[model samples]
Target: MAASSKRTICIVSPGTARDNNGNWHTADRWARFLRDDYDVVVQERWSARWPAPDLLVALHARRSARSLGEFREYHDDRPAILVLTGTDVYHDIHRDSDAECAVLLADALVVLQPAAIGELPDIVRPNTHVIYQSADALPTLPGVPGRKDVTMVGHLREVKDPATFMRAAALVTAPGVFLQQIGAALDADLERLAERTNDTVEHYAWQGGAPREYARDAIRRSHALAVCSTMEGGANVIVEAITSGVPVLASDISGNRGMLGDDYAGFFPVGDAAALARLIDRSVQDDAFIATLRAQCAARAPLFAPEAERAALLRLVDNLFHSIPSIGKRT
Candidate 1:
């Protein structure tokens, strides 16, 4: 595609740069991936005010429902893709009318991971695609020789289940092990809980929502990354941890299983603080288990490579555009 002849793609996200949430990161990264071949525009919403785009990539089926609906109504002939979020697949799509409508209105559906496919309605399964988000590889920094750190990265929300991680911090008894929690407390109660835990727990620290560079640096330097979220649409933290050669200790939810594989050995039951603590202690003392985790993470790392994600995204757009001969190539 030539520079001026490229097709326009509008990515509708409910979050903006300030939000610094998963949806915004996905929208931003996908735009960069698609920009080489398409004219990509990312906005909070779409309306009649903006010129029509060849395709609309809407994030969060429920939050972006109005934008998806408006774009579909405005250009019924142009294809629109609905990107399912954790809440959408696990909660909203089953109960919310707007979310269900977004599913029906889209020409195609995209799930961040394969496990999410089982959550979608059977009627729309034929058109659904899996597009794993990507992250560039970061060099693995060696852990401090005398101490080990496990970091959990996510906002303090009910779905993320940060309480479990905080409780696990109290339960961990391994020598020279520390638990680090990164992310802003989106809820006041959770913030207070984190503060109390930090005050009492000898080896726990709550470093609220640092810069992206700091978070990535922490992951690269850690012994393991902990993701305690009960629901996830394929977490970007998992991708970052895998790409950085840091193993993950994840909740045994379908979304985490989809990202780490069913056979991975690093999962603890969701919300089981004792189980997470046991795993954390083991990850510190059991070198063999850590090695196994590293190997498994390395095996899955290729799936999140920048090249693979870009190719998959480009292929989906190309196929969707080609499916309709009349509008295959935008003038």
Candidate 2:
């Protein structure tokens, strides 16, 4: 074991920086958040060769199950946290045995939004905690007169439901309304579809696989951010939008409801392109509707602040450490 003064924390994430997906970003942000207090290391997988950590924080129950299971098996005394992603909350936990096993192995469970707790088994509910992700506030770009930009930020993946956004591009007839999609083409078919949409729709553009800074700037410049996901543990993009002073038009789903609140006025039905298009059109034609959305997002902004997220995260870590009197004394 390596000699270290600060107790080490290992974060296991299946995705890497190159992927630029939600899991990787979450793991990276968490590593930054916890670094001030602990020795934090983020890895795609945890291995025995690494110095034993005082705590293990694994993102994605199904994907990180093997590492989480092994860590608990060897270091039963140490705390292990399992963060349930969109797939785990809405899909995998109900059907996947490994995901269920991972749930049981965790000493603490984290859900990105509160509604996700309802998706977990009764046994896991008590241990589950909601931690809304955070992004630093960005300067809201000045809106160009006579132009309305609605931006969607997520990789071209099935879960993100990019097709809905593409189809909505064709349906939206409101002049000066441009639908911009920014993400990597994780799916070849979606890439081709995005290309077709760009060629056919006068107001749609696909700027593929941008750097994080670029994406944030795009969100900051947009009139409203569109989160068209079929599932989301809690979207980091939504937080970025709120912090950047941009409103959101989200898909109506449990995960989104948890993030935006049930009464949020800007939701379109899941996978409904026409409905999404109508919402886009309404946002362009009705300034009052846009103002309402902005006010609602502003009300929720503090919840996603870095200070609040950091305090909640540290509170959880401190509680876990104190619960086990001998947590950092491991050989």
Candidate 3:
């Protein structure tokens, strides 16, 4: 394909793609979105031997640090977009040298949540863009409808705080309520927690890893989504819940707040099982309050719709290609 006729873009996500959990899936979603307009290749890793593309979009600064460095060394003049994941934005950028290098090496930075940009150093602030993740609601399930089911969707990991949701479910005094967690247990400790929670709480069930369709169906069928995360780079669960018309009870972190809005009332302090329990109780017992949260989530749902995300991404790509003198030229 001729250089001008075919726009080649490469996405580097060095994390294990087999897991297909969070950031890996995010990279896949963005790749699918870009595929229509550009020739896009998604790879777990990129090396010096890889062909140079017109643009590179990489996810997870620390995980793809080597790939980012290689891309920079090999394609210095090409525009590279580095997407900051929860770990990359919250943990690695502060402590990991490779993560910091990825930030400096990129022509532009992408953060899923608005608050994530605050975590970036002032040097890269100008180039950073906040692009919220998107999801589509699946067809409604055929099961019983009236019983309120609170769902939590995330791979069981330390950062995700799966225990918080389980503990909250156990502590919830409300009857006729269920707390379902659907994700693969990525950590041994979390697996133990899930097992224990299942044995102890009659209402809590850990339905180990389901396909994305099943997960989305769970979200659609649920009364609400509980996001008890220690940190996030704008979780896709929040977007998924919003788009599915399910209210959210999220941790009071900037990442959650960035997606749920700073003024959104459905927030509990991070890692506070008691607070989460209280929120769960209130969501079930207080109809007015729950409706208010639902309304707030509904108001913000359009921001995460597929159309909005696609437009913002295309605009970003167009601006990058047009502004960069070398890449815009048809060879």
Itemize residue pairs with steric clashes in candidate 3: none
Tens digits of lDDT, candidate 1, 1-331: 5533778899999998899999999999999999988889999999977888888999999999999988888889999999999999999999999999999999889998999999999999999999898899989898778889999998898899999999999999999988999999999999999999999999999999887778989999999999999899999999999999999999999999999999999999999999999999998889899999999999999999999999998899999989875663644
Residue-wise C-alpha lDDT for candidate 2, range 1-331, written one tens digit per residue: 9564777899999999988888999899889999999889999998766667999999999999999988988888889999999999999999999998999999999999999999999997899999999999887997667788999999999999999999999999888998999998989999999999999988899999899999999899898999999999999999999999999999999999999999999999999999999999998889999999999999999999998898999999989988986767544
Worst 10 residues of 2 by lDDT: 322-331
Which residue pairs does candidate 2 place in steric collision? none
RMSD of each: 1.7, 2.0, 1.9
lDDT of 2: 0.92
Worst lDDT 10-window in candidate 3:
137-146
Better of 1 and 3 by lDDT: 1
Predicted structure 1: lDDT: 0.93
Give RMSD (Å) of candidate 1 vs. truth: 1.7
Q: What TM-score, over all chains together, does every model reach? A: 0.97, 0.96, 0.95
- What is the Cα-based lDDT of residue 164 in candidate 3? 90
What is the alpha-carbon lDDT for the whole of candidate 3? 0.87
Residue 329 lDDT, candidate 2, scale 0-100: 55
Ranking by lDDT: 1, 2, 3
